[model samples]
Target chain A: MIAKEKFRVCPDTGFKVFDTTEKLIKINAVVAVVFLAVGGLFGLLVALTRWPAVHLLPADLFYLVLTAHGADVLLFWIVFFEVAVLYFAGSVLLNVRLAAPRWAWAAFILMLVGAVMANVAVLQGESSVMFTSYVPMRVAPHFYLGLILFAVGALVAMFVFFGTLVIAKEEKTYEGSVPLVTFGAIVAAIIAVYTIASGAIILIPTLLWSLDLVADIDSVMYKLVWWGMGHSSQQINMATQVSIWYCIAAMVLGAKPLSEKVSRGAFLLYIVFLQLASAHHLLVEPGISSEWKVFNTSYALYLAVLGSMIHGMSIPGAVECAQRRRGFNEGMFGWLRKAPWGNPAFSGMALSVVLFGILGGITGVVLGAEQLNIIMHNTLYVPGHFHGTVVAGTTLAFMAITYLVVPLIFRREIIWPKVAQWQPYLFGLGVTGISLFMMGAGTLGVSRRHWDMAFTDAPLNFDVPPAAFLMMGLNGISAVIASIGGIMFILVIVGTILFGKKRGEDACRTNPVILPGGGATVMAAGSEGTLKLPGTIALVSVFFAAFVLYYFVNWKYLSEVWPLS
Target chain B: MTEHLNSGDGKSGDSNGGPENGEQRIHAMQSLLDNPFLLLFIGVAVPTVLYTVWGVMEVVQVPIGQ
Candidate 1:
């Protein structure tokens, strides 16, 4: 007979947490935070170097730091946290014991080794090629080997998640379907499989080329395949963040999806069309055909945008529905107004949804358009768009969820509750400023990869408008602020985990959080049982209006650039 | 209502309420999500529309002389 498992039944949500899953979640989360600290430091250096006034590093060092920043923040930190999230969704939410605990540990070790190898390669100054690593500009063999090892490790972790889901099903953990959060995670894992496969297909050959075993690695072919992994990795973030959005809404405010059917449809949409967004990276490439280009950019892409727009609406709609049910139903936005604004979990997610939808989602659709891609394709605007999506949208959402993780999983009280409340806002404001200023600078034709905004040492000196310099200076200040916010988050989470008092069962009973206050009750019988979504409708309309206006504005801008003759 | 979910009184009762009742409710919800027609609609309809849009854009972008 299979051994009976021990479960720590949470007093708050009644979740049966397996000891192994809990341990794995804590290890992965702690490591993710450590990488975030390293990446954030590198981010500061890159930002300062980009600022004309400060100009912190020389060109070569600037490139090295930039490479490290991208690899750590974008790949290492995010993926590590995502592995934790995958385990949480499969084992914790599904109320099942984790499968293959030994294998999971092996996966974590491989990931750690790979991440260290990659970072060491970059810092040793041989692998200064940026995150894209477009070749014939080759790095050392270890650089590619590091990435391959990390990918393999991450892929193994995903298999563990899948195995856990199978265990949940066979063990009859839940009566109906798995929880929606688990379902969303399934989408992320599925996409991750595709992404890792894509990465291996290209990276292995490129590694051979790097080692001089292969004759040549074509640049055009590399970009086409590399983007399949590169851009699709962000799609994984999108799915995971949206999943967290739902979790935060439910845990913090006691919300449910407005319609589970429609919400799942959106996730289904992501699985089908979201990867097409990778085409935006190849829009300017000459080797690609127009038929392929147009199909990916406009036709295939708009459908994917529709999927995101669905989520962009449904997430907040669910939140509003929950808030209104709690008797915050005075006006159209009273649900929003009366929300637990002081709770970092709720506020962080709320800001993530808003800023991402406005800054990231709109700019992404615009950038993907065939004609408008010309205007901002390789400019500072590219990074601006990502910061909005990846940082503002995904990273902030992850940060919001960590507040819940500390209390719910770790069973520790937040060390500084008051400071935690301000962390999201400070970080949100700084990132927003970063996205806007970078986009503004790009609109004035600021080069993206250059260390010097002034281009002082170039053979041919180019004069950009003075506004670009001002934008870079402003971006530097914003980066500093964002870094402080990052530090605050790390301190709050680490301090809480290490030093905060252990909570008794009674504390868990009264307040679902290990944090200071109680969460709003999540009742199945919400006011949302009857459809009352006028507030959400109005909000969604505003988003639609902004999208249309910005899209048209980009088209107009494209028209003004070297008239279509 | 708030008190019910907040204290988790409702959740505990629902789980212990009866396996049959819980399974029936879940079955009803899962059927809609699992329907082949709905799955096809979700997976295929958007890409088909996108393809049509691609065709139109290609026609629009055809050079004036050619």
Candidate 2:
């Protein structure tokens, strides 16, 4: 039986006996990091194999490893960490315990089981469906079973988060409104529910087909629903990463935004528009109606980009506001000089935002354009663009959060604080270097996911300048360096866990000098208490109008084109 | 050190005492039911059972990707 002491709670102080929620968050973070590292290694292997000069790994091994890497790192690691962040948002940020701790653990177990089964099946060569897991290229039944189980676990976690929010409201733990971070998390969780549900619809049918229990499933239908999961999940990633930016900025620099109202409003905008932006992926795919694709990709996606721009400006605006308060009289860019650069968390966030804006933003918008996409589709540019946003933006934010969370939750001093300082720089430089190289290669027309271009009739010419191959080789080398940097990060975390000093008497010191007034300052100063009912109503009305307009326009065109078959 | 850390001193500045704390404790207890572990179990189990049952019911035998 679980000990009563383990389950004990102090209501007056709002502390749990075991601090299970905090423990679970740390565990999930570590697990996700491990998977991420494995994924990175796999990625490096694939890049090396593809490089013209150094074809290190064999062809079959290359595809298999790439599939595993995408599934484990991109899908599993990011989602699991997001769930961990969801729990942190619910319990810690909102100052409410989980609605169901037992159920939360159950979800973790299910995800673990599912992840294990999927990984084993993939490694054992029973499945090689790629990360997309497109039908026709089938895997064993267990692979699909594992994927389904993982999705279900994710869905349950989402429900628990929403349920916790409702209870927090009912109990009146905090007055007026949910915290901004928690609010963002709720929006992300809602997106997750839709994404995972769509994934379930696609994967479950395919799983049956793999087992010889179903004769055939329509490939077109599978691709359609699969993107629902694929694209929606990326939206969730975007929302959660943006929210983390806020949290990390706040914690690291004692920074508050110029206007909490604007920041929170931006989050709400993401909830309404982000999923629609996913149509950008389907733009180049065949079988989808041109009218539907055009509307979804161009108009809807532009609105999503508008939301991203709002967030993009707000982070700097918040920093500028904070700096102005500190009496920094420098011009627009001078405020950047006043910003804290020594603090690893602050620097990491600052660099990530800049990289994400210039590299990720420019490339992404260009790729999303219908005409430009026709040229760049399925090319090295696609991965380069995504890596800029995901690895440089989202992963870097997660790394920065580790600096804050490890100290606060685990009560462990970080090991080699100076070495920890260089991690963001090394990793960021490597990623940027690799992405630029790939972008250059893409400009010269290099295709993605190909094993050997030399064997094909239309082989990539080594004769004529060799610039593309040279760029690709540089990208591979950068990946190796980036992998080393990632390893250094893991070592720091492990060392902190094992060898760092534990917070003894200091654990009871509730107030830190950094955050002078603690929770009260945030609650009172921020927009939580302000009820901008008019603004909220206006926002909702705009969303509804946009939805109706998009629906009618697309419906009219689609009807004319297809004529209901 | 462990004993000293665990021991409750009268001078220790913990505000709420015994029975009142118990009431708050009960409220907190009620919240844990929606924990991720329990949700995860239900999420995985329900889907697994449903999918397995569906597969069993369908008796088609064609090679994959035909």
Candidate 3:
């Protein structure tokens, strides 16, 4: 062999500086926060309108706000933040620079322009198609155009992520296989591309219809394709949320998954399976073939859920291992006691996992079932279930990640650490209260999107008792409480960004903090500080198994028969 | 020009080094291009593009039913 000279390696891994990924994350976080505020305002309006006593706004205004809330919060805020997270994971975690910074900027601008145009059009009363923007409920051409532009921008961002992944592999920046978090994000990006493509398929025609280029469009087909966008986008949110859960756990607790291979394998399965799982949304819709519906709602949905479940179990497994390493002698649940409860990232993530499992997961699985869906479809329970998943699960995870990123990227201390500590609890409690109330009313046959339950002038078919209406009013109050928590969160975030103390000497330190784990034998001290492999793998694997189990059940039950027929 | 070149190398990697090390770096970059994940991304992306085009074509062909 030719004599090879050894190159001196940089100690810090040079991952932080060259990556402009952190800046991208900060920008996305700010935008997402604004969108969350806007979305919350709309949600408040809708809640008040639904409250029998309040009836705060007129029917028309109610619909507008309801539509805006869904579009802005569910679609816009989540997707934009997801793109930013994708950029962060693909570059920072993988130790690669962005493929094209200029292109990334272009994508952001396009998305912003689209969001602005869509909002303006909605406010002007030009498009009242609701968040689905279904055909036959025509909106202005600009509305569709804005949506197209945003989707295109997101598509470009995905391309850039893939490009960066290519560069990272070429650079040999990562020693082993890609990290679990980055792998999960890559899967999310892949699904996002498909979801956006589906959006373009439906929206372009709707735009044409608005321009009078086409006479009309099929409502049923439009719904089908739109769900391809709608439902699939939500799956992207799930994947991204799961990825963040892993990252937050790792960062805050210094926890690692027990089995890297299993966790990574679960992520790969998500990419292959989640996109096709959009059929669950159409199970209750008429005109869709029974075979397609069954295959979609049961089989595909189960697969997606299985992916989530695996991650759910895996995260806690890592936490347990980390706790044991920190010299906690508690038995099966002893690690939990020793774990850092004060850390915002750890608490937020732990709470999110619990809420998602008990509330979100249960409601999601039940709703995906054909027979159960018929009862819950278009009820207050529908929004209740989704809020548990998307808002409580995904949005809360994002907030937890933000707590970490704010310090790392913005170089600021957290303002109002005390108030920030209570945010997740108050907000989560309020959401749980509201969702439970809605679920109760829904069980008694309460409907959604109705202006007035008291107005008997129209023929009312369902016999909903007066108590249900009263309970809905109570739900509205819970929403108000949640909104207060949300406002406090925003203030804390803004304060941190503007005036938090910047870390000075501590910025140069790179010692890996050791977390509590299950045993000392499994924890080895090395140059990297402490290695807790089994715990990390266990944490990641539990969620992987849970997600797989959900999908398996869904496939077995829902995919075999078309519930609609 | 010299300053700009120096900065790029300093940020990225050491450009002026032993010929053998430089050659190894070049080989690494080439190997990265042949990564399976990169090829997988491209492979999936092409079909996705094609499907998008096909879906768009269907939209263009069918007239809106009044």
**For every candidate, how close is chain A to the native chain A in TM-score?**
0.96, 0.87, 0.88
Query: Could you give candidate 1's per-residue lDDT for residues B3-41 as a string of tens digits?
Result: 111112232222323444233233343454433234434
- Report the alpha-carbon TM-score of model 3 versus the true structure: 0.81
Report how far residue A446 has shifted in candidate 2, in Å. Answer: 1.1
Model 1, A1-565: lDDT tens digits are 7687787987766777888999999999999999999999999999999888899998899999999999999999999999999999889887789999889999999999999999999999999999888998889889999999999999899889988877887887754455667778887877777677778888999999998899987676677668778988898899899989887887777776666656766787787787767778878876456777777778877877887887877777877877776788987889888988889999999999999999999999988887899999899999999999999999899999999888888888888999899999999999998999999999899998888776787899989899999999999999999998999999999999999878668876565552222222221322233356888889899889989999999888988987766
Candidate 2 per-residue lDDT over residues A334-428, each given as its tens digit: 55676667667777787788777666766776676665566657778777877788888888877877776676666677888877888888888
- What DockQ values do the models have? 0.08, 0.03, 0.05
Estimate candidate 2's alpha-carbon lDDT, on a 0 to 1 scale: 0.67
**Against the true structure, what is each candidate's TM-score?**
0.89, 0.79, 0.81
Q: Give lDDT: candidate 1, residue A167.
A: 81
TM-score values for chain B across all models: 0.39, 0.36, 0.39
A best-first ranking of the candidates according to their DockQ comes to: 1, 3, 2
- Best-fitting candidate, scored by TM-score: 1
Checking candidate 1 for backbone clashes, the offending pairs are none
Compare the candidates by DockQ and give the number of the best one. Answer: 1
